[model samples]
Target: NTAPRPWGRNSRNEVVVPFCYLDEETRKSVRDDIILAHNHWLRSLGGTASKDSGHGIKFWEAVNKKGDPEYCTLGPGKSWNDNVAINTVVIRHLANTNKLSAPIGMAHEHQRPDRDDYVRYICKELKDFDAAFERAKRADSRMTEDALCNKPGQAKLYGFRGEDYLMGVTASALALYWPVNKVNAYDYDSIMHYPTLSGDAKEECLTNEQRCHLVRWKDPGNPNDRSVAMVKENLTPSKADIDWVKATYPW
Candidate 1:
């Protein structure tokens, strides 16, 4: 497409690439690319879009306005500044045609691997971004579950199954996220949500932001990628939750 893709570094060869893929990682990446592109596009439209929510084609005048997802208007040009502008126009057409889908909770799936969807685990920790997205994809069936492929960025499937199972997975992967976060977070909240304060209980337990702090990140420099950063907030241990973690998974 010769456009500047997200997470991409264009070379002098004029061969632009996407931060994510479009063939196998196509499904989820469609949304991802749109999200990445729109981060720049939305501002051009005279409105501020959430780095998380705005990363989709829903706002395009086509589907929202005209209807099309495979247009160059949505991608950027060689210049890094051109990506959002190009992708913004492109998504409008995609949105109109019903080709684009939602981004969040997305499953980056493709009918086939564009290059190497089965790359090695990007994080190789207990849980990986490719894995989480893959889990969402497998849970949906549109995505693939080839963990051994060695493509490095492809996703794998993950499910909590139950509180215990999630705790188990979290425990297993804790080695991945723990050493870095500093605190030996033995407590992992799965089932019991943050206690919602109604009456005088408003000041009770931790807020959502506090909870999100527990989730691991691929980027040590930018742990919080506003565009796709999962909400770890209000997802940690409460009094009961803490007790449950201690009793259930004391490790």
Candidate 2:
């Protein structure tokens, strides 16, 4: 789901996020990293610490469900309703399970990646756009189409599905779920952004040429040729990311 959780306030007026682990042992592996990462955003809002009195967000260990040792009940109390209780955050090890397929370091809001489904979505958006553009190009004069693709402003519309449509979909989802305002430019440095090399083992391409085949754009002068831009992994949230959270849940 792309909707934001209806988080409840704690005694300190901080938004309480009730976290649970499918494998309780996993908690030990990720606790420090999670706290440190969250602290970055908390500190940006002028909070002294992540869970201190001045902080706007607090992480609480969810109470375990009755008779179920593996899974813990979501929300603050016995009821599943978040509005009446606390917001829930569940974490699972994606590597250990065959039930869901996701990239090693990838974090999706909901739904795991299915190979066929992923290809279909990418083709539906990117290939459909290309097909439509090709039809439009055929209807117009060859020189007209060439000139349009060669223009700096129009070139972005011609051959960059990965940079444009794919990234646009992700950005739209983030804006819909998060408290961030819509932005014209995509933030490549956002921690939520996927790296250029991100994919399953089967999806990994050995060379840049092979990788560019998946998503590439034409340059202003090189209308017929295509180029790929590498997106490095963002280890932490960007300044814009921190600002969005601070604005949404101010201390």
Candidate 3:
């Protein structure tokens, strides 16, 4: 667990650490990726990669106040100011598996202090889609409300009532420290998922990521860790997750 945890250092010279547990490799990868991404962003700024607009350097310097205030990553052992910090990032690790997960952590979209706004927006959008679909129904096809979302193993609309909710609770706590907008759908199969917690599985649970209830039955691994919830596995984002991203952050 000595892996370097990198986060977006803000103008205030601080970062929102997820305090998440990740294996050595994934953690390192994330740290490296952040640096690379930030560097890439810097190179793209002022229009040319070759010319260090000093913007990239300045940006990282402010965000990366971890290791050295002056040198950024070029300073010494662990360079804290190495990249452009992205907000609302969620760092996650699995409990007891060799699952190869990505370095980028995810932010919980459901528990944004603005949670209600997202729900309203998504619900309205869905209703609008429902109406549009009805108008375009094929001459020989009959579309039912269930048909719109009742796939073999998916939730009807946005998992309005299920494990997505439970996992969201965990994300909420983690997100309090991060700067994020709350208009995202829940990700059941994410590293950020509660290890042993989930929403109402019976209502709208995916076969692979469903759970029966939303209680903290046991502490993760630390007996003294009185925390009620836990994360179980490494859940890579699914197609549904991608759809959520598109909906929330429209390109």
Residue 156 displacement in candidate 1 (angstroms): 8.0
Q: Which stretches of candidate 1 lie over 4 Å from their true place?
A: 1-58, 63-214, 217-251
Candidate 1 positional error at 249, Å = 47
User: In candidate 3, how many Å is residue 148 off?
Assistant: 46
Error of 1 at 63 (Å): 5.6
lDDT (CA) per prediction: 0.27, 0.40, 0.33
The TM-score obtained by model 1 is 0.18
Cα lDDT, model 1, residue 222: 45
Where does model 3 exceed 4 Å of error?
Answer: 1-72, 77-106, 109-187, 197-231
lDDT of 3 by residue, 137-241 (tens): 542156443444322212223232321332223222222323344444544444334333232233332332222233222432233223333334443444444
Ranking by lDDT: 2, 3, 1
lDDT of 1: 0.27
Top lDDT model: 2
- Candidate 3, residue 184: CA error in Å? 6.7
Every model: Cα RMSD to truth? 18.4, 12.2, 19.5
